[model samples]
Target: MKDTSMPELRAMCFADLNNAVKIIQAHDEDDGEAAEADYRDAGFDNQYVLEVDGNIVGVTGYRDVPGTDQCHWLSWTYLQQSSQGQGLGKGMLLELIEKLRSENARKIFVKVSDYEDPELGKIYQQALQVYQGVGFKEEVVSNDFYDEGENQIILGLYLRDDEDQLEEDPAVSEEKPIIRFDGLFEIAETDGAYTFSWIVKETKKLFGKRNFSVGDLQVGLESVKNEGGRKVFLTFPSNLPLIHSPLQTAGFKYVGQLQNYYEHGVHEYHFTHDLNDL
Candidate 1:
């Protein structure tokens, strides 16, 4: 490469979309196209790119966690394969952290999957190490989150001093079957259609496993179908066996499960309702 200008971090622009996605695709071919669509729909507000001499080499950003006080989930952060081993990633991320601190963001979290390639080995380990080195603590781990044997690890970093922070102790933590359906929410909308998700929580036995009925599911689906939504999705831990009959009766179809998602031997079950079929 010729004498390029110094690397600089700046807000991503519409023109930088193609280059940024290319950087992401170079790292993981499967994720590039969907990620690009996400940016177009979500708009490029806090998203940024690392540029050198007018060329984009890296891209990273964060998405706000709804209902939380300035909580955020880190977005697709990737650099060109040729740029690996350099301290550029560290510098870029630190600047982003400082930027979030300046914006008074409370906390940030990132979810990474442990996928090992047959030849390349663990693909996401470097990124995980980088996050840990920057003060992000382990929040949770879901075995087989992506697929069979591929686990997901979530890490969080406090951006501001707060009193309500967590002091989690795994040993003392008792499982609670407190199930709550926070209502129907749209997760992805594209191609003139929307895909929404519902997550079932563990309902305590005292409250009765029949806390919800087919009518509730039908009501939520009716509300979304009338609003131009195309598909409604739902997921729950397979260990919660009581939820099966009720959901099946509500016209929801069982899709599949991610083994060991909630804990060892337990899995996450997926159910979906398609409005077009109705």
Candidate 2:
């Protein structure tokens, strides 16, 4: 049997990658591959290894979110099956949270799957509890995110006091504006999933006719369809008052949201379109 005593957390080295994959693979094969890919893509600079008697028992890390200077997303956190049930996961994660807080980080988020199997018996639920116990707050929930039954819950932990962080929506005014499709791109993390970026041009008049309509959204849907994407995801800042009308008219559904993803109190509202529906 492996030693499970005297756990230590250390920076993971390149040599630890293979061993970490094996440890996680013992419990989940797909996640093992994902962990490897994440390390290769982002490097292991922020990742840590939790060890027992110098043997790696757990891996955890955070990655910076694009367009945000201080916000991060937790990545590929996992543990050896044997090391579980002893609070090592919580200890390791708490240490990571402290590290983030000390570094003047703003917030950290994690996406957890609500997947349960008869054999596994609500495995991810325990992870949810651990995260919540460590002060993570639920931000949004996307149903059927991974499959027909499994849902995705996004949680956030604020490392700093956010009472003064809220900002007014600068783009929204008393005037009508021009909204247009900006571009389309695949969500690198999921197959058949795509997102379209858009541009909203602020107008000068208080009563200018609304330049945005269902046509703008339809154009984006066509781009997704042309790219052979089955799903189109549109996430806008919740502070925007104009996006909802066009999106609803174009057959998009509100699925979920990510809290404060754009700016403080300006959350990301999730909308989805199924190309296969037609």
- Residues 33-77, candidate 1: write the lDDT tens digits: 868998999989889999866678889999986544677888988
The digit string of per-residue lDDT tens for model 2 on 4-53 reads 46465789889999998898787677777777887888798888899887
Alpha-carbon deviation at 42 in model 1, angstroms: 0.8
Model 1 alpha-carbon miss at residue 219, Å: 14
Worst 10-residue stretch by lDDT in candidate 2? 167-176
Q: Where does candidate 1 stray beyond 4 Å?
A: 1-6, 165-278
Question: What would the C-alpha RMSD of candidate 2 be, to one decimal place?
Answer: 5.0
State candidate 2's TM-score.
Answer: 0.79
Q: What is the lDDT for 28 in model 2?
A: 70
Model 1, residue 105: distance off in Å is 0.5
